[model samples]
Target: MSNLSDIIEGFIKELLEANSQRAIEIQRNILAQQFDCSPSQINYVLTTRFGNDKGYMVESRRGGGGYIRILKVSTSIEEELKNFLNESIGDSVTLNKALDLISALRERKIITDREQRIMQSILGDRALKGVVYEDRNKIRADVLKEMILASAENDM
Candidate 1:
């Protein structure tokens, strides 16, 4: 059986797909109860799976009648690449965040299969072992930014 987080994520995605509007509203506590998991698990799946880079936005209202609204937003490849450029810090990226960007690029089909593998390999923490977190983050940022630019050049 799939883990609760994956199950919950799939269920929510199914709901979004079935809806004509491509959005869904659900009560977090109710979802947790339905899945027999803690509310934090729902939060984990939403943050890691339905993230902004994955083309989903999450909104929440707290208190008695609180609800979580998930909206699917569309973005062009160019715009997404530009967003990555804008968000990069000096030259380093934490390993997890670099992997997130690589996954996003792959999800958008902005990078080829080979490119994805190359990026994943080079961005691995093991590849940058012994480098401090701050330095790794900046270097990852620089390399990813360059890769994005190279992709753009190929498009022209």
Candidate 2:
């Protein structure tokens, strides 16, 4: 059985997929009622899943007539790649950001399904066993850079 958090996440994901522009408040009460959970439970899901780093922007209001607005920031994989290349990709990028970037690339068709699987396998925590977090991040960045460079060269 799915946990409450997972259930809530799935519900919110469905809502976003069905109507990306729908305000969060529109479904809050209904979702709470359906899940038999408190309003704050909904809030917790929103904060954790719809965070800025996850490429979602959430705005909410409190009190009567208040609303919660959720926006999916559509970002290009090429733009994200450029950002990753230019920014100080610290010793270990958070797992969430790395996954988000990979997902974006897959969505944009920048990476083939096979390549994604390979990359995932190589960068997986198990593969990085014995390495410290910081070192693992550095290794991941190096590997990612190499892959991106090869992909670019192939495209050229």
Candidate 3:
């Protein structure tokens, strides 16, 4: 069975899908009531699953009129790639973050399944095991950025 966090993430993704604009405003309390979970649980799912690194931006207003707004940040392949390179990847990225970024690329059909697997293999922790702990993330970021650029070049 899926965990509560997974379930809530799915529900929110469904709502986002139903909206033509690919964005949604939701009430934390109402969603918490519906899920029978605390508002903090909802916040956990939103931050971990829908964060900027995962290609979504979350904004929340706290109060009686407060609401949470989730926005799908990328509109086009170019824009998405740019965001990943210029913003998401940054100077250093953990292996998990790199994998998530690769997953986002695959989700958008920016890369094929085979390509995704290949990229994952290249960026996986095992591949970087020999590197110094402090330098691994930095090297990973540089490599992934180049790979993304190469893929974009091929598409052109």
Best by TM-score: 3
- The 10 consecutive residues of candidate 2 with the worst lDDT sum are 83-92
Angstrom error at residue 49, model 2: 2.3
Best-fitting candidate, scored by lDDT: 3
Cα lDDT for residue 89, model 3?
A: 90
Model 1: residues with Cα > 4 Å off, grouped in runs: 88-91, 125-134, 152-156
Q: List lDDT for all candidates, in order.
A: 0.81, 0.69, 0.89
- The segments of candidate 2 whose C-alpha lies over 4 angstroms from its true place after superposition are 20-30, 83-91, 94-112, 129-134, 145-156
Candidate 3 overall lDDT versus native? 0.89
- Model 3 poorest ten-residue lDDT run: 74-83
lDDT for 136 in candidate 1 is 78
List clashing residue pairs in candidate 3.
Answer: none
Residue-by-residue lDDT tens digits, candidate 2, 38-85 = 988988988777765455678877776667778776656666556555
Ranking by lDDT: 3, 1, 2
Error of 1 at 125 (Å): 4.2
